[model samples]
Target: MQSTRKVTEDIRWVGCNDRRLALFENLFPIPRGVSYNSYLIMDEKVTLMDTVDASVTHQFIENLDYTLEGRSIDYLVIQHMEPDHCANIEELMRRYPNMEVVANQKTMQMIGQFFDISTEGRTVLVKEGDELNTGSHTLRFLMAPMVHWPEVMVTYDEKDKVLFSADAFGTFGALNGNIFNDEIDFEKDWLWDARRYYANIVGKYGLQVQALLKKATALDIRMICSLHGPIWRTDLSYFIDKYDKWSKYEPEDQEVAIIYGSIYGNTEQAVNALALRLAEKGVKNISVYDVSTVHVSDLIAEIFRCSHLVFACSTYNGGIYPPMENLLADMKALSVKKRTVAVMDNGTWAPSAGKQMIKMLEEMKDMTILDMQLSIKSTLKQERAEELAAFAQQIVDAM
Candidate 1:
């Protein structure tokens, strides 16, 4: 088992992001990969924040053993019931039958439905403003409904001033040694993953996010423990501010994300043309990322921050490119709202990428599709190339 990473004096990074995994949900490139972060807070009664993926059950057990030398877990707090975080809930129940599962009504419903993880024997339902006493520590449950998941709730620790936030304000990349926001290099360590996590995971519920933000405004949060990223100990406001911006779906700059999944060079060529036009258009922060080459998580992160998103796809299985298709599905699932988007499609005899994407965008709201999609038949010509350039110019102009 991998060594457990102790995040703070009382917290530990008991889970890891096998960065080697190429796909998330069997589809998106996790890139910096992912972490099923579980924490063991050696507080008053020794609370466990969450659990890890079932695949890493052995590692999780070992980390748990190390964390709880002689101490026993009195409370296993289930902040989110998503399989990634709650798959081991039953296993934990079996191991510690006396341990209480602290969660909300929605979480219990999900548990019973999915894993049949019954709280009949051991359950403690927390309400919107309920506090649980653990001797020296006071934990407050803040209901964050639909901020990614309906069952999602954040536990506030007044003693450590830590918010055991499940998925809120989390990032992607695996941590090196540092867990606190102040511990890592802000530019390199956290920025990319923060953007990716927010864009891909919690992009949908901007309003709920606003509500949660408003709710937390009164609390003096000193630390943030998220399910997928490192724990924030110092300068936690940095993450809060990022969540504020990302959830709003506001553009970070006049930049663009050129995403393409090309089997041949046709779609790539179109992307190249677009990139060239973007350069010619005096766009300074333009970036072209190949969906096939880069992870969708990173691509999503870029999309959330950029003002414009341009997609070029080589028709695959009669729709968007495989990687591009996965990216689109991820975007749709995240329920992205309010973004300017454009697309390009490539085909040998059948041209469906453009029309297909247009239809998909219809399912999305507040998305302004630019007036055109540059389509190429098998290959592209100077005229088609010029059309691509024109589209890029239009995107820049819109920005």
Candidate 2:
């Protein structure tokens, strides 16, 4: 019943994976589900890092109980107060009556806001550089506000060289027995979801993330125990580099991502032609997506990954197509920038989506809009071969 993994000799992963949840935060789609990671440190003074979602409370409890082995919890660290990670706080407090709820002022306030828990004398209020000594392991708390939440903070275990990264460096995937990042091909399998999670969930807080990264550089973090996703015990920089790049609004790849919106598939067809042209021109890793079908989160993820982007959309009611328009809004809201973008629009009579899209893109930071704006009337005709070739060449040249 106790589905747990050992992080270190004394630190046990009392986390649980949820494969049933279709959506994370009821917005972003999590087809691979997600993991709510909590850790239990068996030291002279027992400490529970955090709690999992209510969906997997039973398994989390079992894991916690089994790891504790009748030893009462001494301290419970509240890193990020998001409901997914804090759902079991009250339940945990009820179980461990003497457990000191260790958190910052904001975190303590948020705890009271979320649950009707009496923290009269059981709360251990800590600040930015506060240290919590649990025997040989000394945890130095670093306040990482708005890394995803206001009350967010990461605990660094001085003894083990491990950083208890709350929601930072986290991904949206359930751990399928392999709890460590080295156990799976993260780049091939989990990178997309990780990008999506960061882009959609924490994309808006890039500045905050950069601040946290700056703080992290000073610490010798050998292991990263995130509140979600896989534990990082090896090649920590491999992931840390990703966080650094992503938070800087920098592209992960120099490849192109073509996101299209089509009503009767005309725009899609045009996008396909362009994609083929780009591919033929030796543009590798070209991704073509129909905005109507592919989730916007996935599109955002691809946008974050690729350096070049092409938006092909059909005009609807003298405006940008709904899905494509929605995606553009999301991009602007998430502060997506520092990339080259090409616009293509299809219209039966009037083509204004391209113009409107360019207008929207202009509002963003440092976005280079391609000069060759391809305007398709009803459909892309064979006569437009030279024009399309030139357009594709521009993208190729930009690369």
Candidate 3:
């Protein structure tokens, strides 16, 4: 009952897909499920790239057992210490008693913290620009300190020119038997989840990602094997360009997104009107979302994609709506910046959500808040048509 795929003549993919898990890290919803990718390189010294989560330990072991075919693992590379990727290190060590754990200094320390094992002579401590030779294939270790984790590093295979990227180009969603990017229509089905994954998980470490990309540029990489989602074996630039743009905090599309938090539907109605006005002005890439209904991770991903944003909310107890506030907190936490934003608030008594939201946005980096603010009392009445028109015009002019 082994499910495996071949990356090349010598490399085999032994990853597992989890469609039963409800959330990723118990925070973001993964309706499409997620994949825990682990690769095995067969050479003079058989090496296992990484291990999968404990939830899929049975399947992972079966895949490894079948692929190994009685040959013991010679080396276990620990690229990241996250539980999801490093859950069965002890199990793996126990299974291959003579196998050595190859990792950096920080990762070695984390091994002691996470498991009851002795790395006295069973570890190969590496640093930047270190190389490990397993027969003809040589893996060069490049330090990527905070690509998302402090102990992160990527391994480059000299023989096959495959980069064993830990999590840099990873996405959310289970692989439906299509392991390579060329096998599926990645732009049509997988881009959104990829954006969400990067925005929420690796978005905070933009500078570190940029550094990693620079290091990768020196290597002639023909394939990317991450510990999550699909492997890239063709048109590597397609995904690498995405990583470059995302790490630079640049919008992938010159689009506008209107996110609103409405209590009794008034605020949502106002957003609808604004969206139509923008459409009339020939803004074709406009998207509307109800923050109360959508997850903050989705909102953050949209915000990251769009160059312009509109936050429409209803004030509650003289403060910004809770969901809208939560979205703002996530944006700030993820280092979201370099965009234009417009604010709208509706409140029967003391309409202060607009000002409060503006205050919060001001604390972020490189955010351009439109000078025009629309304050609605209970509802946006017909008499305020001219004011609403002016507000929409301001956004159009900025765009």
Candidate 4:
């Protein structure tokens, strides 16, 4: 049902959706929906840089047919082999018998494995710096290994100064009929999910991304056409700057992400108390997330952003609390590194929650444990609340 929307002069977004996969459309907590962005370049010869999901191949063809009435597709560039992006490649090629697939060695292997497409010497295998020219438009490929996939490559178009960046600057939510960053609330809706996606999916590929960034800076890029989400036709630097920081595993700001696990309401009160204290102390930014509520991926993103992290848990099974323990385990598995740590636990019988949390966070790299652990007995007394507030103060001061 999607159209071949023109994002730029020569660049038309022929991307389609997987609404059945997504939970909501154009909203936060993006559940089932995904966007498969395909682009058409009109030059002496035409090339389709990518294709939509197989689920929407019919609609995709309709869009392509509309966008390209009499022109024949000369090339089909396969950048990533993830099924959502490459599922329709075979169908597309079948529809355009003369279309030659341009991909890397790894991509060809994946193409053969994922579908019935025969490499059969019909592909134009490209290397790291290989270029493809369609008379007017020139495309330069950059290998991006482990930026979510090993076979992934990003294309830079010299004529339009556009980088057809496959999934590099993508996010979850579908656009609201406007395919630019300026059209949406970048700070509120997309930023966190974008960070979460990068952290969870491309977290380990910082070095590869660093290499790609260095190579890309040599070009005059005016826009970025990613395989998902909106095209970067305006203010491209914001996404690039974010990539640099996230790739470095550097904190996005001075904010603190407080993830708390509350058994009853006692531990929750302590977390709320600390959050209010942070707000009252004039520390502009803080995230007080319930481990019981927030997804672990989102938690990981916040951990990436905040220089300070706090955990509150209630005792269970004569051992560490469950939620906090799970978060810590996930963090360790992700190989997370950050600035400071704070732990608050509530244990009526054995005071093991605080001790366990402190031990786990102490093991994190480049992490300086704040010398404060608030362990509550049965309930939060007035005195304990004051102490928790002071503890929150100490964390703010340390930050």
Cα lDDT, all candidates: 0.80, 0.92, 0.94, 0.81
- The TM-score values for the models, in the order shown, are 0.83, 0.98, 0.99, 0.91
Q: How close is candidate 3 to the true structure, as a TM-score?
A: 0.99
lDDT by residue for model 3 over 165-192, one digit each (tens)?
Answer: 9988999999999999999999999999
| Overall local distance difference test of candidate 2 | 0.92
RMSD of 1: 3.5
Alpha-carbon runs more than 4 Å astray in model 4: 23-32, 383-386
- Model 1, 1-399: lDDT tens digits are 556776667666677556666676675566677777888877768888888888778878988887788677889988888877888888888888778999888988888887855678688889998998877778899999887898899989887788888888777776665656677786576787678667766787888999999989889888788887777777777778888888787777667877887896877877887787788878876788888888667777787888788888888788777777777777788777578888788899897888888888878778899997788888778766567667777788788
What is the overall TM-score of model 4 with all chains considered together?
A: 0.91
Best by lDDT: 3
For every model in order, what is the number of clashing pairs?
0, 0, 0, 6
Ranking of models by lDDT: 3, 2, 4, 1
lDDT of 3: 0.94
- Best first by TM-score, ranked: 3, 2, 4, 1
Give the per-residue lDDT of model 4 (tens digit) for 1-399. 448778767778887766666442222345635677889887788889888777788888888888888678999998998877888887877777888999999999988788876757568999999999998888989998877688999998888889988878887766557777777778787787788777776766777778788888888999888877777777888999999988887888888888888877788887887888888888776788888888777888888888888888888887677767888887776667756888888888776788887788777677788887888886778866678778988887897
lDDT of 3 at 321: 97
